[model samples]
Target: MYKYLFLLGSSLAVAQPAMAEDGEITVTATGLAQPVEHTGQAVTVITRDEIERVQGADVTRVIQRLPGTTFTRTGPMGSLTLLGVRGAPAGQTLVLIDGVRANDPANANAEFDLSQLNTATIDSIELLRGPNSVVWGSQAMGGVMNIVTRIENGYSASVEYGGDDRVTASAAAGMTNEKLEAALSAGFVDAGGYSSAASGTEKDGYRQYNLAGRARYHVTETLSLTANARYTHGKVDLDGYPPPNYTFADADVTEKLRAWSGRVGALYDVGILKLNAGFSISDTERVGDDPSYPYSIDGRSERAELFGRVALPGQLALDFGGDYEWSRFSNAPDAGKAHNGSVHALLGYYGDRLIVTAGMRYDDHSDFGGEWTFGANGAYEIAPGWRLRAAYGEGFKAPTLYQLLSQYGNPDLLPERSKGYEVGVSHGERGDPVYLSLTAYRRDSKNLIDFFSCWSGTAPLCATRPSGFYYNVGKGRAQGIEAEVGLQWAPGLSSQFAYSYTDTENRTPGDVYRGADFARRPAHMVSASLDWESTMGLALGFDVRVVGDAFDDRANATKLDSYALGDIRASYRVNDMIELFGRVENVWDQDYAIAAGYGTQGRAAYFGVRLRK
Candidate 1:
């Protein structure tokens, strides 16, 4: 079924550009909501049109090519998507939906699984590489990924269906006439997922369903209210290992999980002062069927944040914000809770050719006490198309409920913290068709955590298991470089290529001296793509992604070699109201794992038709 779709797409000519903006600046890292070229942080932006073309199964596949990002493989959940921004631990990074924090508080690492997010609903994603805790608070140790949903001015709807039992449908409409404007969007998605574990194995297959809705209304010219809600349910069929040399497992097991989240926000602009406030809630549940693996986990999380900025007469800007968050996790015999509060402020000085930004955040957590983060950023325009930027900051991530109070968890876990710095160079004519940027960064983490003993329920040997009790390990450091080039060589031809590399290590007291390299983080990665409009109503594109080798264990005992993958897509307009398209993924049939023990899809394809009025 998937093959036929690609075939039809290949038979078609090409695609046409949609009604999308080009080169919008991002202000996620600065906390000022300004453009990237005017800020010091290293940033990468993926436009909505690009997201529509990739149509990947998950965010990992979608942004893998972005600089300093890598992916790990896990069964059913598929690629355990991990982004190594400046070589920091995946758990140290923070992900945001709109402006709301989206990292899971129930997990040991306080990391948000990109796998759970449906990219079909995303309008754009910005990757900010560097410490940004002064603005975003905890878990921004490595970087920040801000996902912005689409907003429309009028009625718009789309239904997309493809391979691996994947289907998606979405609708968005808005009214902007008269004195009021309102917009609303809803989406649904389901997938049977990719094949991994063998038959009768202890690991299970994957099945997932998701739904999301968003709405916004303008109460007045400068006042607005927005709300968003989402629900997801997924199950993993697990299989146990195959005896003796349990180097890897191929068994099938059953794991069920459900999650729901909602958020509401209000914004008011009164010339000199712009004020914004929002509240968010999330709940999660997980159930496992196997008695040896009999597990039940539940968690509830809530957060409230307020932001305000004031403009001064002399090109001086002052921004301030505060946040309070709480979470509770329960697994019957084991339970835990955490709470934290933070206040942050930024002072910015702006000039025609230079901008300086300074900010700091003070957070007090129930478990880890108080932590303070500070950052400084500055950018200067050196010439008509060149800019120089520098940034330095401190970041942190609090331990999650699972790390603090699970069956074999450690309640004494400490928050991991880091100090980071970055510098970059960018060149591009304002509103030009070509741009190039490069950045170098380094981050060091303290009080890192790791598993120590095994599950202690039965015997000592069982506790010796790899997945047994974990504890704070010590310190580590990661450093890397990122580079990108965006070009529009002709009227209808445009291309982009980005690459990243990192050096990582775990250096702490009494830790096993394995190797210099950190496990699971590839040293090199690259992504490139080209888009072109062949005719009045046809468009064509091709994309390629590559990753280097990485270890499968902390001991660095095993390694998965590097591999590259490619994909092709094309679309044609049958008429003004109808269009046809198709896509081919893994065109090279690369048989490599993002992690050990898992098989990536070789070569696959899919087709579809789109209609518009």
Candidate 2:
């Protein structure tokens, strides 16, 4: 059925007036430094050009188009996305920025809003599906997402302004004549939208400013030193809405986050061994002002990691690394502390026709003892342009401080664990205009934790609202198939289409998670895009996306129906220093919710001009 659907999608794409051929650029996919042709796992990439064309409002909008992925938005700034490879929880996925981990330490059950990341500075993003903990460790039970930043060799600047209360201004300058290269960038964005049920009413959705810089110097022909620094701060006015009233104005509710993060690393290459070591740190502060709630939260996370890889004679490669992380969280009402240490190693063989990898890591936490995870992956060339790959891995997520020591907490909760496997094949001829990839995977989780019993009667000593206490309850499983095709059909005209089918179920009995299909696991998803690059310096693009039905509430009481969305974009190159562009979202005027409870922007269009040097 998926193959037939792909064929039909392909035909429609080809019928489009505009499409272009695919380009060649080997990317980092196999946890290695060098670019490789075949990946041992399902991988999807979004380029900067594509991001600009789509005018993607957030990370959710950009990632939903990928296979085996689903995003649920609670509001403009309140969003939780589930990237399931087979059927893993959203927490099973790991996100990285320039090789540094960025998962929130406050929550272990939900994914942080990917949209919080500024897109203006992103060069490219890589989404790898299936178990990758062998190389990434811990939360990588489902997949890994690596966001790479742009590297500039000279000065470049751009100014963008749009409707819907959207405006962004950015500039970048760098220098690299021969041996040394450095760059710096700054960006700011502000947007306002309707406050939920209050149609015609205004709300403060998002306002943020960011600054980043990087430098790299060649110490020798085979060695280099690189460093990067970035700082961002944002103030979000929380539109705290209760059940019926979608737009409840809470003048007292305001959220603020400030962060300072950076990385310093060195890389050396010798014929027999390749070495890389890096140290990264991110300090974050979160504060909330809600008179109705009453309290302020402050958190500080300090992390240091060092790793190296060496290749022995033959095709054998060995990687060993260790890390230490410390976090001290203090609230105006109280304070807590947690620290972690880990050591890991991976062994792999990369030959002409086949590659095999195995790895393991031991993690120790001041609060949760120690846990170990291991995995194996392999890929073999079956024929020209055809490769078969498989992977099996075990991953886990330790309970967060909020879960273990919240106002109503549980000290007996254990870390959730998952075991998963995936098999797939990829066929693509080098330089060919067409490429196809398919994958199937399954994942099972145990010791699933959820808020359990609550304290009855509002006792001052035991204040446990319905939020419940964290407990190890049910078991869950997920399986799915993903297929993707890309074709540059002829010239100037090209198209890309992807489809996914997922089946998710819960075996956790009891009132907590009884007889419910995972909270936000959409059963089916698809994305298709067509583009025409005119020989006359004109570009046109169209995209369609569909997400199947899924439950919105934890109890599965409210059902959010499936819906399809479409968008169009075009650009005209007027001259060497100027270009005019416009984009229209929800072209069909489909009234849909990108996230439950939050009203999405109605059909809207924006036109803007880009000035560059």
Candidate 3:
């Protein structure tokens, strides 16, 4: 399938023009707006039009189509979902919502739950792959996902229903005037879902509600103030272990989560410099309720940041920034608090044919002292239709509050560190009708944190103990090649293809699980899509995804077989204000599992109607 798609794309590109204009501009890489093709890093941008074409209800569904990305979801919608980038752990990837950190501080791994995020209010998503700690600070050992919400003046609404008693509805409205722009969106989802356990028959259910708002006021021609806020509440019925323990049955577990975030900032444009300052706060609370026991965990983060970019003489530009963050975690049993301060400086040179960037950052943590990270990237336009890019960077991740102050916590844990590099070549411009890119990268990581039982005060090899402690004793390496091709064949016909080959291994020597592949991470992944829009207001789309087999446990005891999924969607606009759409997922109803004991959705169909201004 991949070979055929590649050939088809090549044939279509042969008749394309020599030069093409750039598409949307991105700011996730270096805090500066630049075309994705001009940046040295590997980045993927998903625009609003593409999102609507795909009919994705959540961010996870859209993100899964990107190269070198994978996700594990336990059950149906509203279930716990984790994302991995380039073979990196879920916690290593940083998630940002309009420049505010979204990772849960109370979680043992400080990972963000992608399931909590819906696409009702999102305008665009910028995925910066590979290590980006130099400018993003900690928890960027894998990559960064920056979500930009809609602030344009418009009004839209949608409603849909499908299998398993699923129902979804969303509404958004915005207005723009001479000096003010504001937008607000809200969404709700409820579904009677399948059980998490493979063999369980009892039906589990999930429900969620989300609301977001953004406002910007131009104080003057040279200054502006902006504010953004979001809230999400979710509940899911969980299936516990089926047998033996009997502590809690599969039908008696439920989990609830509430999260909210708010940010306020100001932007100033001077003669030769741009300045930005912001303050933000976010909180998440999760509660697990069982017939026999109930527990709750809460986390909060407060951040203040300031940055400036100066256009210097010649082709050089300078960027400098500083930030301070305070995080707290609390539960019935214990509480923890920590803070960190970071400062970074970046320099860039943008010439006629070459672009170069270098940056360094210093971070001081209240619990673990200080650390430094650096990065360098360059891109050269070898010809009108060819370009070469290379980048090298370092990354670090701090211990989470749960890992530091919980019952099984270790106060002596060290931060995980990593270094990686990538080189790539591409044919085409930023907005070329047809473009292709091939990239190869490698990353080596050390001091990865893992929980281990400690008995008799032994090291690396410990006996069974009632409780375990977090230790920085693991090492790993990931290498991969990613290829992407995209083309707009004609007026409304387009296609995209992406393939990735990943080689990952646990290099922790002297351990029982040494040299094993990472759990839930596929070694090979392929994604392809074709879409067509007719002049008569009709659109059709098809997508295919294939994932290679992977292990479900560290010991390689359980395996998840390879699976291929196909989906088709169509939309017809009745007029300028109304549209009808429908889609079929898992068209073949192939039975598969992304996790060991979880059940995946089967053939399902949904129909929806959209109304726009």
Candidate 4:
């Protein structure tokens, strides 16, 4: 039955008029600008309008609204935060900033920290869930998040001040003409947050500043050159164990992070063929100051890519791309360099009622040699106002430099691999009064690297390497159902509800923790929101989220209780150029911790205003 469904979705379907959702265009799915219907991937697009409506410093506030998505924060707003999808860890999610890979290569797990990003200067965001390594090269075993900064012709600014002595300010200006388009933006945030440890009394503080710029020059009617760059610097107070007790508690420590990325590309479009070529680079440095232990880590990555799509007869197109990337770490990895070269191709069929795409990628890594991945997805209109969709994708992640050459590294460690399959049915158009979707998905991963102990017995490098070593000895599987409903109950009023149920297990045989539930992954997650607008220039919104219990340790020795949180917001437009807004977060002051011994924020309120022209 599944094979028939896959074949039918990929090749067999009748022609008809395109649906409303097909009008939306995206570039993350297949590395080409195409209508949403052209790709068969599970994706979500967060528009700028929604970003403005949320009006929060932390972008995770809005990201958690999506089904099968969740985040855990070590402390308040600016502390270390990690996101996961379908029970996968943070390191498996690939993050891109204007086409530049932003994952830090110096980190042991090579994960992108969400705490370094906010909603200040973003124009739009695209989240591709599940394994999509065929389009994005590595670190995409879980998903892909593309953060596209604002590039518009206008002037806008905002300022906000609220609890915890938080102060926020941002501004952007741009110019657009026939031959040239350019923009620049900057933002700053300073907040006195609470301590990270629940038992601590000292308050931690966070500060960040960011600058971004974009430009595009049209040299001819069908040719254009584009460039964009971003830089961010952050400082956060931290807490750690003290010498006497060595317990998780408050201590005077601080960490600073600096990251910068840039991309330059050219585009050529003549209706029949579209091509995009670019070179991108990213660098990150982190310095931590502690009384007992101090450290510094620096990482750099560079990439060159070229991709294009050629339209053909019979409503078909061929998309192809290739990329070469190199990265290195300065500290723990001991200046080791890593390289990967990849090439991919996809064939897409676009019909009135059916849209499907199938692609494959081959990656050559300096450490692991070569790996191949394949992805396929399709959507078919079963009847008026109804559709069915299915997708299958494979992903792989090469061992990071820190994992391979660090003090506890094991050179024999191999790459991790994953496979994901999803199928779903939906009713009504995306903007219709009543729209609903239900999807079921499963993902399996092998060769997962975990920390191995050398205390009990002597392993290969255990004699010299007193610290534990990393080994490819873990396996995992996650299966889940996601449901979403959107309703326009009345004029100027709308609501949305999303729920996720995930079943995750440790699948490594003969392991003490095998068959146990995955750590930090809740079994159930629910979120709902309501928004209303009136002609009188007034808007009101409310959001509610409830998460189920989760274990903080794979051994299930520590449990993190489930909790519910709510927020209310309101905005009023004084005129076309000015607006006022405010929100009360944690309205009930529910005290809960996402991680063991981590403190959480209580009730907090904020107010702000915006000016645009």
Report RMSD (Å) for each prediction in the order shown. 9.1, 9.1, 8.7, 6.2
Number of backbone-clashing residue pairs for each candidate, in the order shown = 34, 9, 0, 0
* Clash-forming residue pairs, model 3: none
Can you write out model 3's per-residue Cα lDDT over 1-613, one digit (the tens) per residue? 2223322322211110001125656666776555766578888888888788888576776887789999999876777899999999889999988778899998899999998888887877888889989888889999999887776568999999887878888889999887888899888889998876777778889999999888777789877777888999999998774346753335678899999998877777675887667778889999998655678989999877766679899989888777778899997787899988888898998898899999999998888889999998889999886789999989999999887888777778889999999999988742358888898999999999998766535553233224677889999999999999989999999899999998999999897888999888899999999999999999999999999999998898899999999999999999999999999988999999998778788999999999999
lDDT (C-alpha, whole model) for all candidates: 0.70, 0.67, 0.83, 0.84
What lDDT does candidate 1 reach at residue 493? 93
Against the true structure, what is each candidate's TM-score?
A: 0.88, 0.88, 0.93, 0.94
Write one digit per residue (lDDT tens) for candidate 1, span 266-340. 666777887666677878777877634577877788777666789898899888877677789887777888778
What is the full ranking by TM-score, best candidate first? Answer: 4, 3, 1, 2
> In model 2, which regions exceed 4 Å deviation?
1-31, 36-39, 77-87, 108-110, 197-200, 241-252, 331-334, 429-432, 456-468, 509-512
- Candidate 3 residues lying further than 4 Å off, grouped into runs, are 1-22, 242-249, 428-431, 455-466
Ranking by lDDT: 4, 3, 1, 2
Better of 1 and 3 by TM-score: 3
Model 4 lDDT, full chain set: 0.84
Top TM-score model:
4
Worst 10 residues of 2 by lDDT: 12-21
Pairwise TM-score winner, candidates 1 and 4: 4
